[model samples]
Target: MIFLLSILTILNYNSNSIEINNAWVRPAGKGMNSALYFELKNSSANSDELFKVSSNAAELVQLHKTVNKNGLMEMKEIKSLKINGNQTIKFAPGGYHVMLIKLKKDLKTGNKIGFKFYFKKAGIIKADAVVKSY
Candidate 1:
């Protein structure tokens, strides 16, 4: 009975997982820079921290946020972002986004790119983003 309860607990924890949706990457040429946007939803009862992001599409993948400093807009790199329980974070334009620096190759329209998101509790969450010209 103890073993059965343990199994059920693990299953329930997995069911309440983080969800990534509407992931998309901007089109860019080789050696150029691009950005990725997505919506991250945390459904678990506990809050999570997103610490790192990685991708093979670019040489460097970093978390960044657009800020308006002294009436000038600038992009700044952030160490980590916290997602509250049952909350949704939108990584869109003029907000938090993933910077894809030094592209390995041309990302044309409809091309797909894979990324890995490192979290504190949910572990590594893999997501795919389509190349688009938004």
Candidate 2:
């Protein structure tokens, strides 16, 4: 019955909410760039759209997608990311991610950054991005 109760507890959360897990930011190397990764579990029983992402450490932030064109991988902006009912979408390196633009400072290991995720249904969620190696 605990499993069923767990289900109910999750469902009882905000109707437009998402559970974010493994939230992290990449440690800066020679470059001033960093990437944020997370797993977003949609338990709202409906679709949701991720509209924007932002952090105080960057001048600009955008939802990015890695596309391979002729074996060359390039990053591009994604206006809206869709999440299906009761599904988890992972944002990680070598795949879709949140691009932190124009670093304010170098992100070192053990450091952390705070981010806000804005969505159509969920409104906003504040999460910490823990720095770690790739």
* Reference-based lDDT, each prediction: 0.92, 0.84
Which prediction has the highest TM-score against the true structure? 1
Model 1 scores a TM of 0.89
TM-scores for all predictions: 0.89, 0.84
Off by over 4 Å in 1: 1-12
Q: What would the per-residue lDDT of candidate 2 be over residues 84-107, giving only the tens digit for each residue? A: 889999998888899887788888
- Tens digit of lDDT per residue, candidate 1, span 50-85? 999999999999999999899999999999999998
Best by lDDT: 1
Q: What C-alpha lDDT, on a 0 to 100 scale, does residue 53 get in candidate 2?
A: 92
Residue 36 CA displacement from its true place in model 1, Å: 0.7
Poorest lDDT segment (10 consecutive residues) of candidate 1: 8-17
What is the number of backbone collisions in each predicted candidate, taken in the order shown?
Answer: 0, 0
- Positional deviation of 90 in candidate 1, in angstroms? 0.1
User: Where in model 2 is the C-alpha error above 4 Å?
Assistant: 1-16, 29-31
